[model samples]
Target: MARPVPAGTARADDITAKARIRNAALELFARDGVEGTSLRAVAAAAGVTVGLIVHHYGTKEALREAVELAIVERFADAIASVPLDSRPAGRIAAARDEAVADMLAASPAIVDYLRRALLDGGGEQGDLVSRLSQLSAQQVHDLRAAGVASTNHTVGEQVLTIMVRQFGRLFLQPLVDRISHEFPEDIDPSRTPPRLTVELALDASRADDRD
Candidate 1:
C-alpha cells in the first residue's frame, strides 16, 4: 500500500538510522558494561531494527571500540585545553581539575564507563594507560619548569600513581563502590572532599618551592 522511497531518500534515512544506533549504543555502553549489553538491547534503545545495528557495527566488540574512541576523544580534547606553558604543578593541577570537571559535566556517563574499565580491567585499558602516561609526562615537565621536587622515579610512575589515586577517589570508586566494598577500612567518600586530596598532593609536590 505504501510507495517505495527514492534511492537518495533511503540512503539518507539509513545514515540517520546508523547515527542514532551509534549514539544510543554509546550511552548504553557508557552506563552498562559492554559484556552486559546485547545487540538487541542497543537496537531497541536506539529505536532501530537489530539488522541496522549489525549493518553499522558488525559485532559487539566493534560497537564497544567505537564507544571507547568517542569517550577517549572527548577526554583528550578536555586535557589538551590544559595550559602547558604555565608553572608546572599549578598548571597540571588546574588542567587536571578542568579535565575532570569537564568529564563530570559533559559526560557523566563516561565516569561510570571509566570506573567499569578500571575496576573490571576491560575495554581499552591500554589506551587509558597510554593517555595517563602522556599526562604524567606533561606533569613532570611542568614540575621541573615550576621548580618542584625532582624525582628519580620515571614520569610514568609518578603519573600512574597520581592518576590512580585521583581517579580512585574522584571517579572510579565513587561510581561503582568498588573501593568501599573492597576496603571498608579505607577512608569513606563522605568523610573527605576530593579537592582536599588534590590540594594536599599539590602542596607536597611544591613543598621545597615554598618559603
Candidate 2:
C-alpha cells in the first residue's frame, strides 16, 4: 500500500491561498506565540483547510520562517530607505523616523509580533534579531564612512549601543505607555512607539510659540 503525501491540488498558482495563509498566520502568531499556535488554528483564521496550508507551506515551522523572513525583509527595506550617505548625522533621524512611521502604519501587527518574538526568544526570533543587527551594523558602518559617526570609536560597540536602545524602547514599553498619555488624542500608546520624548518637546515648543 502506498502512503499519500498531504499535498493536494495546491499549485504555485494558488496565490490567494498562499497570501491568505501568510497573513492569517502572521496575525495569529502575533496574538498567540508560535508555540501556542497550530496549523489548525492558522487554517481556521485563514479560512482554509489544513491540507491546503500544508500544500503551500509544508509545515508550521516553515510557515513561521516565511513570516519571519517577510518581517525582516520589510524592516530592511524601511531602514535602507534612509539617506544615510547624503544626510547630515543629526538630520538622519527625521528621515529614519518617517520611514519607520510609514512601515508601522502599513503593518500594525508587527509591533505585537516583535514583542512576542523578542520576549520568547524562540524559533527564528534569534535569526530575526541577528538579521536586524546586521542591518544596524551596516547603518553604523555607513555613518562612519560618511564621517557622521565617531570614526575613532569601536563600530561594534556603537552597534551594540544602538541595538540596546532600540530594544529597550520595546522591552520597557509599560513605563512608556504609563507616562506618555497627557495628550491622548495626539499620541498613540499602542502603536510601535516613535521618539515620544522628542515629539513631546516639539509640542511644548509649539505651545510656547502660540502663547
Candidate 3:
C-alpha cells in the first residue's frame, strides 16, 4: 500500500494536474507524434485548458523534451538496477532482460516512443543513439573484464551490434514474431534464448587465444 499525501495544499493538486497534462501529451506524441500533435489536442485529452499546458511547460518543444528525458531516465533506472556483480554472460543477459521487461510493464508507452524516435527520425535521436552506444560499449568492456566476453572484439562494433539487436528487435517485433516466433515483449530477456552476444564473445576469445 502507498502512503497518502499529507493534508493537502493546492501545490499537490497543481503537481497532479501537471502530471496529467504530460501523460496526455505523452500518449498523443507516442501515437500521433510531436509534429502531428497539438496543444489543443493535448489539452482536450488531459481535460485541461490549453492555457494550463502553456503555463506549465511554456512550449510544445519543452514538453516533448521533458517527456523524452523522463523516458530516458526510466530506461536508465531500469538498466542501472540490473545486478552487475555476476560474471556469467547468461546471468548478465537475464538480468538485463528482466529489467527491460519490468520497465516496459510499468510504462509501455516507452516502446512506442523509442520505436517512433528511431523510425520517424527526430527528437534527439542522434543523442539517444550515442548514449545507448556508449552504455553498450561500457557493458561490453565490463563483460570482457569479467572474462566472460571476448576482449578481441572492438567495443565500437559490439555496441553497434547490441543496438541493432535491442532496438531492431523492438521496432520490428511484429515481423520478428511472425518469422522468428519469438516475442521479446512476452518473455523476460533472460528467459529468452541465448543470442549473438555470447557467440561473439566466444569467437573473440578463441581468436585471441589462437593468436
Candidate 4:
C-alpha cells in the first residue's frame, strides 16, 4: 500500500495543478475560442485528466469566469498604476496610452475573451461592463479634479464612449493591424505608442468644452 502524502506536498501539488490548468485553458481558449474549446481539450493541453479539469473548475462556465476575472484584474491593476496627479489632459492621455500598452502586454488572450463576452451577452459580459463603468467613473472624477474640460457630458457617457472605443480596438485586431502598418510604431500598443483613439477622444473632449 502507498503511504499518505504530507499535507504540504498535497497543497503544493494542488497549486501546481491548478496553475497548469489555468495556463492551458488560457492558451486553448485564446487560440480556439471559448465555445470551440472543450474541457477535454484543456485537460489534454495541460497534460492532465479531464476529471482533474472538472474537479478544479467544476464547469466550463466557471473556467471562463476565472479567465475573465484574471484578465480584468490585470487591466485594473495596470490602470491603477498610472500616475494621475499631473495635468489632467496630459495625464489622461498618458494613462490611456499606458493602459493600452499594459493590456497588450498582459496577453492577446484578453482580446479573445472580450470578443466572446461582447458577442455572447451573458453574465460575464455584464460583470465586465459594470467594472468598466466603475473605471470610467474614476477617470471622469480624476479629470474633473485635474480641471480638464468636458463638463457637459456626464461621466457615465464619457466612460461608455471610451469603453466602446476600447472594445472596438480590442476585438477588431485586423483593423488595428492594418492601421499599425500605416502608422508603424504609433499604433503598436507594445511600445506604449501614441494611439489615434486616445488623441481623438481627448481632442473631442476639449472641443466639447470649447463649444
Candidate 5:
C-alpha cells in the first residue's frame, strides 16, 4: 500500500511531480525519439496522470525545450565553475574532474539526448552548435590573452580544434573504449588523468604572433 502525503505538502509534491515528468520524458525521448514518444506514455512512465503532464508543460515540444535548456545550462555551469586565474592544466583538471563526476551521476538518457539531437540535425541544433562554437572561441581568446594558448590559429580554427577535442569524447567514446580495451588499465590513455592534468596549450612563447 502507498503512504498518503502529509497535509500542506501539495506544492512540494507538485514540484516533484513536474521534475519526474521531465526526467521520464527525457529518458523516453532518448529511447524512442521525440516523434515516437507520446504524452500518455510519458505520463505512464512518470507515474503521473496525462492531465498533470499537460498542466506542467502545454505540449511535448515545450517539455523537450525545457530539457534542452537544462542540458545547455549544465554545460555552462560546468565551464563557469572553473577559475579564470588557475593554470591552464589546473583549470582543465578541475573541469575534467567535474565532468567525470557529472557523468557518473547523470542519467545515461542525457547523453543519448545529446547524441540524438546532434545526429538528427534538428532545427535547434544549429543554435546549439553556434553557442558551443562561440564558447570555445571565447575560451581560446581568454587563454591567448593570458599567454597560455597559441595565437597562430584564427579564432575559427581555435574553435574547431577545441570543439573536436571536447566533443569527441561524447561522440566517440565507444570506439575509443573498444580500441583501448586491449591495453592495460594502468596506462590506458582513455582513463581520466591524474589530478594535475598536463597543459593542453601550445607553447605560445615560441610561436610566431601571427593570429
Candidate 6:
C-alpha cells in the first residue's frame, strides 16, 4: 500500500519520477540487455514520456549508469545495516545476515542485473566489481577484527573467495536449486559475507566479547 503523491507534484525533478525511471530501467535492462532496451521502452515501462527520460537522464547510457548507481547503493545500504565499527560481534553477525537476506529477497532485479553485468564485463562494469570487492573486504576486515572471522584465511584470499562464491550464486544457483530440490536462504555474498565465514566465528566472538 503505497502512499499517494500530493497534487501539483511536478514531473520534472520529482523524486518519484526519477525512482520510477530508475526501477523501470533496472527491470528492462535485466530482462533485455542494455543493447536490446530503448529509451522509448524505458519511458513506457516508467509510465513517463520519452522526452521526460531524455530530459532527466539524457541518454540510454546515462540511464544505465543511473541503474548501476542504484544497484551499488542497494549493496552499500545492506552493508550499512551493520556498521563496521566496534559493535558487538553477535549483533553484527545477525544484522549482516538479516540485511543480506532482506536485500536478496527484495531485489531479484538486482540479482539479475549483477548476473548480466558480471558476465558481460566492461571497464565501468569492472569498476562495479571492484567496488563490490571493496565492500566484501570491509566486512572481512571488520569480522576478523571483531574476532568473528577465521584467522586461517588471509584477507585477500577471503575477499577473492567471497567474490567468487557470491557471483557463483548468480550463475550456478539455478542449477544448484534444481539439483538440491530446495531454495537457498537467498543470501547474496556480494551484499554480505558468506554465512559459513561468519558462522564459524560467532561462538568464538561471543566468547571473546565476554572476556
CA lDDT, candidate 1, residue 160: 54
lDDT by residue (34-82, candidate 4, tens digit) is 7888888887767788899889899998987777566666666666666
Ranking by lDDT: 6, 2, 3, 5, 4, 1
Clashes of each: 1, 0, 1, 0, 0, 0
Write one digit per residue (lDDT tens) for candidate 3, span 1-211.
1112222211234457777777777777877888988888888877789999999999998998777666666666666787567545556655765576566646656777777777776445345555566677776777677765555556776666556655655665556556544555665656754333221233653533210
lDDT tens per residue, model 6, 1-211: 1122222222244458877877788888887889988888878877888999989899998898888777767777787777756476556645665576567656777777788888886846346687787778888887787677766656776676556545555566566557544434554535643322221222443434311
- Note the Cα lDDT for every prediction shown: 0.60, 0.66, 0.64, 0.63, 0.63, 0.67
Give the Cα error of residue 210 in candidate 4, in Å.
12
Score every model by TM-score. Answer: 0.61, 0.68, 0.65, 0.65, 0.65, 0.67
Instruction: List residue ranges in candidate 1 displaced over 4 A.
Output: 1-19, 86-89, 122-152, 172-211
Write one digit per residue (lDDT tens) for candidate 5, span 1-211.
Answer: 2122222222234448887777777777777898888888888877888999889999998998766665665566566566566545435634634564364235467678777877885456435566666666776777677765665767786666565555656677666656555665656476673332222344466333322
| Pairs of residues clashing in candidate 5 | none
How far residue 16's Cα lies from its native spot in candidate 6, in Å, is 1.6
| Better lDDT candidate (1, 2) | 2
* Candidate 4 segments whose C-alpha is farther than 4 A from its true place: 1-16, 86-89, 120-125, 138-151, 179-211
Mark the regions of model 5 whose C-alpha exceeds 4 Å error after superposition. 1-15, 88-105, 123-127, 134-152, 179-211
After superposition, candidate 6 runs with Cα above 4 Å error: 1-15, 84-98, 123-126, 140-155, 180-211
lDDT string for model 2 (13-131, tens) is: 44487877877777778877788888888888777899999999999989988888777777667777887765767767456655755775566567678888777775453677877
Clashes of 5: 0
Q: How does residue 138 of candidate 3 score in lDDT?
A: 73
Name the lDDT value of residue 166 in candidate 3.
Answer: 59
As for candidate 4, its clashing pairs are none
Query: Which of the predicted structures, 5 or 6, would earn the higher TM-score when compared with the native?
Result: 6
